[model samples]
Target: MNRTPEPELMQIPSQVRAYADADFSRSDSMVVKSLEKFLKKAGRTLNKNDLIFDMACGPGNIAERIAKNWPFVNVVGIDGSKEMLNEAENRLSLNLTKNLSYELIDINSIASGEIHFPFKADLLVSNSALHHFHDPYCFWGALKKLGKTKCIHIHRDLIRPASDEKAFELKEKHLSNSPEILKKDFYASLKASFTVDEVSQQLVDAGLSQLEVFQVDELYFEIIGCI
Candidate 1:
């Protein structure tokens, strides 16, 4: 099947509502669980006062988890979607950490050197957002500039399936209990995602060849390592 990237933002009311209201505890928990393992594999540790950046933080779901898990760390989520940020801010009241906040900025603009963030991040993370970029290198460019000093970075995204059958198989295997909206999104994301080799080449082109690109599951690949 040909790859089709979903819209960058869940702007439509129904789409936004469905996403924000859906229960993603299972999948989101997997991401939170993998965070520690990835960090450990990279030989990185977070401090009590570390500043964490969650790029393309749609609706702040993963950001919320990071903040809650690392209660003393300050978390800032950056996204270009106004609607998504609105939903994220609305949910902040339920957060266990007061340090979590969201910023409305075009992350893709980071490559253009047009946006200036107030702080350099100690840790950078993104969950399932890499496939959304029309130009994946734009994200790498942003990382090169923003994470220039030294930062622990990890990005996880779906891996493109070798065939449509494999895509649907993985979706059903992993998302059988998920809501219809999320199930659909998962399939689309798998189509849009890059293969491990493709992502490795992208890293090389971006001068980030040292980052480890590997398959984490049947349908997921992770780009992890500190720079």
Candidate 2:
């Protein structure tokens, strides 16, 4: 798959991490709900003792949910933004058990062998953050190194149809009932969303032929690969 720059590529500016973290905390519930559904559909099992990594885990919202839902499993949330990490730490403080933790790490630098984690993860997940990758292939390669047993789930906004008219029509038709927050999120996601073919091609290019790629809705796409 040819790497293409996302249309709405936006950086998480250093100054806004705290504010962004709060926003993420509020939206965490929705994210968890969506992810839980996807996890069930993927049918990938996680043992109570399994170690999971939440890459690009802004504010550790998903981490908190996973910890709550599967108390026996270990959940580590990683993000490049320190401010975001602080927010995540604060939010998860009350919920902290031995099984949950957070770290500030850049995905790109990790893939380039500039940094390393102490352990390999059993499952690596990212939500609405994959499109921000400047070089997704590098990230995929890093995930592969983490462990083949890992399952990756990315729930992000998808680009509408290739045709502008089709995209607009679909957006208008389906997004009418979406709340303001969701509408905003949906648009951003659509702008950053990749087509199923695009995602599959990424997997193929990364030599992940066994990967499973699918669309969950008009606005969301998923990729599940096991090494």
Compare the candidates by lDDT and give the number of the best one.
Answer: 1
TM-score per model over all chains: 0.89, 0.73
lDDT of 1 by residue, 36-109 (tens): 98777767777776898999888888899989888888899998889888989988966545989989989877
Residue pairs that clash (backbone atoms under 3 angstroms), model 2:
157-189, 157-193, 158-189, 158-190, 158-193, 159-193
TM-score of 2: 0.73
Which segments of model 2 are wrong by more than 4 Å?
1-45, 148-189
| Residue 76 lDDT (model 2) | 89
lDDT of 2 by residue, 134-219 (tens): 56687677777665354554444354466555555666776676455544444444555567787778888988868677776665
Give the Cα lDDT of each candidate: 0.82, 0.65
> Candidate 1: which stretches are off by over 4 Å?
38-43, 177-179
Global lDDT of model 1: 0.82
